[model samples]
Target chain A: MATNITYHPSPVTPTVRSSLRRQQGLTIWLTGLSASGKSTIAVALEQALLRKPYNLSAYRLDGDNIRFGLNKDLGFSPKDREENIRRIAEVAKLFADSCTIAITSFISPYRADRDLARQLHHAERPGGEPGVPFVEIWIDVPVEVAEKRDPKGLYKKAREGKIPEFTGISAPYEEPLKPEIHIRSDQTSVEDSVKIIVGYLEEKGYLSAPPEVNEV
Target chain B: MATNITYHPSPVTPTVRSSLRRQQGLTIWLTGLSASGKSTIAVALEQALLRKPYNLSAYRLDGDNIRFGLNKDLGFSPKDREENIRRIAEVAKLFADSCTIAITSFISPYRADRDLARQLHHAERPGGEPGVPFVEIWIDVPVEVAEKRDPKGLYKKAREGKIPEFTGISAPYEEPLKPEIHIRSDQTSVEDSVKIIVGYLEEKGYLSAPPEVNEV
Candidate 1:
């Protein structure tokens, strides 16, 4: 229990918070094998979202960016990986609560963990069925293709036994069965992938509506 | 190890990110005895900031809200408390990265834990001495006063031995020697406390400046 915690009234429900931001809190979860173009697409998507006429402030939380800071204490063990994803999901939910679009680029090669994240973000409101939008984008790329396009030579390092339990090389990579969006990262350009995502957000009304003229 | 993890260039710096929001990413860390009016003051401060012209989107991370979500697995043990504060600081830093005013209301009774938070937020920037603006606000209140004002029955529970290791009752509350803002919650009005904070932000350049006439 919190030592000095006083249970005050819950200020501003998620609905009210979202209304203030004029946008829905969203999590675009990008998962695939390493070097699968997730982060690249995420970077472009952030810029694209900012260019749009929405109040949405897009924030990308990628594996590299997070590893050096939030999850620096964690290692690559199975338990640690689970904890890492859990923490990241929690932070994404926080951003969602604030009505910000959080893009997470992680090689979360586990089915159950991804489902757990979906459950966390898909929590329902008082009368609603689904709560926040959790768009799981599977950046599908074959191991051969990813290894060939390895930007950091980590695949080479894994093959040389310099790294251990490297996903798709030593550890297993679980593919998603019913992902919200399936991007063939090996085939699709980064720009096209971002277009598909931004278009989906627009079609789904996650982006803010145009301001009304003195509706009050 | 992260599979094929590569050192990618940073997409945006903190300066550039804050420019987009038209505000600085600030963390107001509130620490005090339980029932010391920390959450109340934080709530009022957030509302006050939103009413301003700056693009400051204020978000609060209280112990109650975060306990069930991010730190649900954590307990109230000494070690768990440290982990809890560490994770909260990391999330607050993430919010700061996005240029939001993140107000953390916790009964962080340990000086070491709070100092760790300060260090995490005070990491040096490239070619700079320090990075983010971490404003530690000490919500000081006497144990007698806080016990009298306990809206909930927590103090009574602690008194009756229903709760163990309760700060100011069983455990010690290590007060900060030097904090950015020291609010005597027992004596000051909630409105006045917020005014002191907002005034400090204006003087410290956390709030946005006036709009320029012809600057691209």
Candidate 2:
């Protein structure tokens, strides 16, 4: 066995974790219709945050990871969709609690589902400790523009009646009344969209670490 | 928005993530009967990894986080138990892919459930990349000894028929045939258990960062 190691009795709380990692944990929830450039912007944002002059640990959760991995058992039924979002929100909260920037790119168009996600992140912890920050970024785009773009031809399939109950097509997308950040994807470039998010995080002091603690 | 920020176009793959975070992500899955000291060892291991000499990012997933948060919808039925383990494995894989050590503490009594978790981690990725490592640490302790300790009065409850399908009592506990690390918690102290794990990680070179890359 190993020797010369002292076992610290205290638990690793969020404050202690932030000090050790040199960064705060938060989730940047990106909601939009399909083809709204959410995934594109999310990719660029993750890259920018991982590189200097920030060098913060960041990860993006999207259809690729969630739909295929965690929620593969879930389908398009209303109940399944709600469960899908719930699992995503919980996973993102776990990531945030671990002191990593969690960026979730999803067509989480339902307002209540999105709200539940925000509430989970903002819930009070034991000892009245504040919860991890949740930043909602509405990747706004006119349905016409998103349909016209049709990068994945999902809108075409939806219109052809092949994919029923798709968001912004046969189903409803209740827009966010008070999202933390709003980006008109049809008007802004991907780089600019990322910059807007990075700017918001910086302005809100979520990008930097707090003063050092002697104890790790 | 923000100025002087350059957007790098490359997607943050596992290789890129490891280079940026200065650590490789892996899951340490601890399995045994209840009161086997898995949670205690997990907390100590997480603390040890986050401190100096290791300084790695690590998180623990146990009943406190898993049962109450992500898998709250689940129950104690056979199917629900399987789903519970599945979700935990998937989330642990995500954490590992993000370049953080994920320590999962559970009684995971069945061999098949634990094997499925290991396979998920060892499954090949796209582009011929190696999958994240899964280290199974079996916290070995005799059921009688665990029943004697009965930290939560769970054994008494189990014997009194208060709880059904309790591992090592009503249900079966399948021991691992080829676990990467095996700790006899009955014969070992918590500090020593943590040391044994740390020593194994150090011997395998899992504690250090790889050579720096030019690109982030």
Candidate 3:
């Protein structure tokens, strides 16, 4: 039921919130395989963003925090993985709308799903600058290398019946054909890797300058 | 092709940025139909939240903004509508995550969708309160009263083919089986509607005291 109850109650505009966040910065999404230094590179990138004169908010939608909370409902099935990416993409768009460096590190193995995420970045914003930088950073590390440093022993468990539909082990991992940046985890030193990513951001005009404090 | 690369990058925690925002406060979300007095009461509610001692951030996610942006790609189809609610739920969750009072208004036509949204509130946040209030307020006005007002002339257009599948007109509007609060828009004045909503908020502990402000 409806009435001619035309009342104008609240006054915080979507444009105001979006502009405030945009005046800060853009989001940097990092996608890769497990144990491929996605988190490490993303952290380095955030520190680099922070050291600059301009204010930059960085958010990471990763396994430990996001999976344990927002994405806790999802299992390891392909359909679940697709839904998982879809939800994260939407969240990343919100962070981007708020004008922050939203760095998301997920083992988003499917190219189509990642591209679908990229398409969403342009759709739902206050219509100014881009909201999130939907960057596809492929941390190209061999399965063997990842196996050697399997901190979570996820691969081993996948080999056993402990985990189902695990990527790069029981399941197939489709590599990114045209990632924005390719970081090989075994060959590059952490310092050089961070530098390469920071350099890319600077080149893309995301960073005002190189970070004042560089991590070793 | 994958290769071995070792990158020693520092970990950047989101705690600082999250803390800075949390130092601000929490948000309250109000959802219902068009001409349901949602905006009318929401404005008064903002005044109430602002008057309190807590750091307040409030925003109303209404029809115009959503249609123009986030849910633009989605149609009025059942699947699209579900996705529409899902996307909004995710955004509302984020707003709650940032500790802002996010009052969203829509002619949400389904109980399943409403229940799904209620489920999001139970989702736990790190070092913060759960993002959703299990409370749902139904603004119960008869269809005849709603058609009479036709504030936006929407009901008329819906009757025509101009706006296809309009809720409560061509399509369906499922009534809430058990809402936390119910306000009859026809019987109550705008001011009384505000009082009733604010009263419920106070009863639910969303407000500190009786709201000193009222909308006429």
Best model per TM-score: 2
Give the candidates in order of DockQ, highest first: 1, 2, 3
| A44-135: candidate 3 lDDT, tens digit per residue | 66665544444454556666545654566577678878877877776676665544557788888888888888888755443343434666
Candidate 2 lDDT at A204 equals 98
Q: How large a fraction of the reference contact set does each model reproduce?
A: 0.32, 0.29, 0.05
- What are the models' TM-scores? 0.92, 0.95, 0.63
Measured with C-alpha atoms, the lDDT of residue B63 in candidate 3 is: 55
Best-to-worst lDDT order: 2, 1, 3
Q: Interface RMSD, all models, one decimal each? A: 3.1, 12.4, 9.4
TM-score of chain A for the candidates in order shown: 0.90, 0.94, 0.81
User: Worst ten-residue run, lDDT, model 2 chain A?
Assistant: A1-10
Ranked by TM-score, the better of candidates 1 and 3 is 1
Docking class of 2: acceptable
DockQ of each: 0.44, 0.26, 0.09
Q: After superposition, how far is residue A169 of candidate 2 from its true place, in Å?
A: 0.9
Kindly give the stretch of ten consecutive residues in candidate 3 chain A with the minimal lDDT sum: A1-10
Binned by DockQ into CAPRI classes (incorrect, acceptable, medium, high), candidate 3 is incorrect
